[model samples]
Target: MCRVPPLSPRTSPTISWKNCINESDPPNLQCGSIQVPVDYGKPHCEHFNLTFARIKTNGISCLGSLVYNPGGPGGAGSDVVFAHVLKGISVWSAELLAQYDLIGLDPRGTGLSNPMKCDPTIWNQRVSMTPQNEEEFNQLVENNKAFSESCRNLTGPIFDFMDTASAAKDMDMVRRALQEDKLNFLGQSYDSQLGSRYAGLFPQNIGRMVLDGITDVSLPGTAQLLIKSNTYESTLNEFFKWCNTTIQCALINQDAPGIFDKLIGTANTNPIPAPGCSPLSEHPCRSDATSEEILTEVQLGLIGFNGTVSFTGWPALSLGILEASKGNATLLSRPIITTPTSSDFSFLGVACFDCKATSISHIDLLLKRQMTSTLSPHTLGATQTYQAQAQCTGWAAPATNTNHALKPKKIAQLPELLLVNSLWDPSTSIVWANLLREQLLSARLVLRKGAGHTSYFAAGETSRAMDGFLLRGELPEQGTTFKS
Candidate 1:
């Protein structure tokens, strides 16, 4: 039911770009902003400017523009351009750089677009996501409401329109401003969900689109969460297996799963001490890290893409766990900045808006929690996807862009799409990839037989297959699988 505003004379606003002079930014880096309606239904509604950064190709024949969204539902594409791509490190193949203007547009309310706000003091409170009782569930609801209210007070109307549909509309606005017939997109992680939204809305405007680490928007929110919980639980077992055999694994001499179970129990009872943390400090970590924090830490460590990738390895995770057992939980600490100025809080404003919401009575929430626990015994159903759904239980904003199967009439108009996925991706699973492929008209799936959230960063055969599609309009053979 999302209706994009009809194109009019004022649709394509001119973009004025200037050099990005941040110390780390490349010399050719250009940054600009485009204004789009806060609500497309009412085009005259107050507009917000989305920020973008790019490095224009010097080659004579440019392939128009390629927009890359490093999926956070909240990750700043502009930040990725400045920090990695423009630096000539963690870059696209040189030929892509030579042929296209690689642009990164920070979605509305994230990165440079006034970044969404919530009261850090209220957000930092330790409300258990896995509420075991009515009282605990009430606390969770109260915390979410307080945070939502704070956001509404500070962010104004644009906060209500932070959904993916609004964002896809913003992308089309960028396309018009860029004067391109089609937009070439590279969306990772949650961006797959965003890409799907864009395809449904402006299928004709899509050029070459790649949805990596795919999410099946077709699934119900609860179904997605349960499946992800199962994925995490299964991945945790893989980690346990690796730890038991690897000599470098700190838990090699001990039973890894048994130790993790005991640690979770100990944390629930006594909580772990984080001597290196200061809760009041900017970018603060909790001093008394609870079982919730430990479970969250475990997920972060289990981002096990491959042995060669420079992510926190299984050995490091074992070390983090062993250290937490004694006293210090510093190694497990992730600076959870919930301040108004920090983009840390934007995930809620964006993610909840993308979810399909239904009224959940307290009893229903308890049942959902019970189902989550029953499905994921080890992680306790603590994937970010599940936590996001549960947090949206009492969310104040309406879910404008909901999770549903893509319509064939609209999706049929989309050009060929390249769907890339890791077979063992911890967050978005291969199951979602296959389901998403079924929804699209002409799409190919590239499965990397490895571990990790994304396959592109692997920068090997999988990356090349993605590059082949974008650079020369080539599609990988339908069921290509690459070894990590």
Candidate 2:
């Protein structure tokens, strides 16, 4: 613990430091909390206390705090410190760790911060996300609205302000509270959503920022969903190609997509059974899987391999497909658990606030279903983009952070940033990365011609590029496309 970080100044004079809430928190870490307005517009009405964990550099050299966001709009950095960082399992390298204070943030509606809440009883009800008819559509909307009401009744007004924009504004408060002139940041997946909003709000305070797994939030909701659905369909073909060539694949020498399509047809006519399997087991194995659940599971598996995060490899995915084909969906159905609160509602809560879905009637939904399914037959629009929009159908909170083009004037003085993304990222499509490049005019993109959610998750040439840039103010020249 020699040369550990000093006790940092509080985020506010009134705020104070304390031991981390979790018992296994890192030894040399200091945890604290600060109260930000529940609604930025109504700063004085009420507030939410946000908590954070920090670990200082071991070296005498310092480059301010490296603010990290683990992406899920719901991902809590403080939890990450105890769960992953302290265990030597993280994306941050030793060199960057030596010179920066690591700030572990719990966003307003997540982590140890006053979290979003919904009645487990209400949440447990299962209504089809893809309603088949007008009656089913009304049921889905009713359930979603009831779920939203439960969250609002328990989480209060802070529920409405849980969007990425508010979190971005809250990020600036942490920056100023730490007394850093610039906010050095590492944001992955959905974190880019927050980072872009921050850049649009406070460009002059920009520091060396790296946005990995780049998800562009500026696109219209329908466009975003279709783009992601197309990417997933493409990536699924890549997985099928691997199955055809690799001996490890259970479906080797067999027509994988044909078999998959057949399984979907069977599932539609008669749901596949998972004998003696629990729906929400330790690994989330489930029983009676639907065609929709199968695609969702495939989407999770296609997050790819060899990153800091664990993803189901192609071999495992093939085996799962084989299992489901044999009428045993034990391996194919997961994360589509029976209960809603049992799943990560925070992802939906943050997504609903961010998407601000309007009350479209059954007619509009029927068209969306037809359009997306035709656009992506194999995957059937099983992207988070579609899921988020569908889930927010009847949210009660007003949409405060609606999608729009990024303000170029706000980003004019912004420092150059390194935007890293996977060409075949199942979650964040490469198309969005291109659009984001155009949005952040000064930012340079280094496209990794590989598969995975984020490049920085694994320490390769791409991660090293991000590392060098964040540790120092290094970025490639404009129009220089880097591939690894």
Candidate 3:
């Protein structure tokens, strides 16, 4: 197992990147950075940098590098590609790892790439608008508007450059530079979109590609919001059923049902207090933030259905709200996991760019649907509505193709692919997975009875299915469903 290496001075004469023909660094992968154009359209113009990492066998028997992408328009695939591989499952056969060179490419504006960054205060600000009355509702809109504008203003042209189409082109360029005959692709979550788009554009080049956490490849942004909303709302109900069996969930008031209500109620009224570091601010400290910052803090909770924050830290998030309510500012930021990288920005940039929706109408309809349903009331829609609208309306850069979004094309001749979905995936829910499965010519769907976004790496039986496919090129029996 590769232990975390100590921080060392980055040395000169980085490894020369090309298809590996011999065992260059026995069992240890080498990584390096390559400068790519900021705009593929204007390649001779401005240039930004992206880092690529890989591991493979030596002396010419190497088939080619198999490139992998982890989910998250913002997740670091470069980290996963070089160091990790289905860790919990360890299904990547030793032989597979030894023979096929594994490569991870950080898309522009992501890890090690020239990242597009914005002030953390910009995303952390709270919105004072509660919308209990008409004045508050208008203030809510204005609050969202201003927040969006700040993000846009702070993250200008770099935002537009992060789109998926450009990243797909970048992948092709990497393949060429590596001197590979063809590229093998593996993408999860939003990476599925990245991979599939590449397949659509360059299908003949496809080699051993696997797409997990499938998003609705056929739908545009508007329809995608609807699918995920309805899917997760139902999964939430199922989650509560499981929560009812557990003491942790049962100890709270009316069990899962009541806890859900209480959580939303508190969040809606108070928002969460974020006493954390902001990446965007130079001062790196702020004690007083506005309602917009509070809104941003609460917004994070609504975006995912992963494990709950610990009781100790949970209140810190809550305190972030309490302080914001009192007109005190606390900085908000993501818990430091990996070093802040340019790839992170590129991931978010491409996600926003790939989305086709120009207005908030789709989200507005989703919120309405959630409210009308008995299962999702006391849900976290108010903040998300404002969040999506804020990004799309105020901050999101103009779409490259106002008239075009990827439409699902029938690739009916493809072999049956494995589809994995988390039961309560806040972003891509099981329902959406089922919907996408229907369109596939041959596919098997597995529902992870767990609460998380992507199932393959999140943990569960789904990992077994992923391993089976990757190792033997096998697919689960059609309609396979597994519990966590």
Query: For this target, which candidate reaches the highest lDDT against the unseen true structure?
Result: 1
lDDT of 3 at 397: 55
lDDT of 2 at 424: 81
lDDT by residue (164-216, candidate 1, tens digit) is 88888888888899988889999998889889889988898899999989877
* Clash number for each model: 2, 0, 33
Q: Can you write out model 2's per-residue Cα lDDT over 340-457, one digit (the tens) per residue? A: 3322677877888777675377777667767788988888887777777777888887676886467768878887888888778788888888888888988898887777678876
User: Which is better, 1 or 2, measured by TM-score?
Assistant: 1
Residue 277 lDDT (model 2): 70
Higher-scoring candidate on lDDT, 1 or 2: 1
lDDT value, residue 5 of candidate 2: 25
The most accurate candidate by TM-score is 1
Give the local distance difference test score of model 3: 0.54
Clashing residue pairs, candidate 1? 305-451, 305-452
Model 1 off-target regions past 4 Å? 1-11, 22-25, 85-88, 280-283, 304-313, 357-362
Candidate ranking under lDDT, highest first, comes to 1, 2, 3
TM-scores of all candidate predictions against the true structure: 0.92, 0.91, 0.70
| Candidate 1 accuracy as TM-score | 0.92
Cα RMSD to the true fold for all candidates: 3.1, 5.1, 8.9
lDDT of each: 0.79, 0.77, 0.54
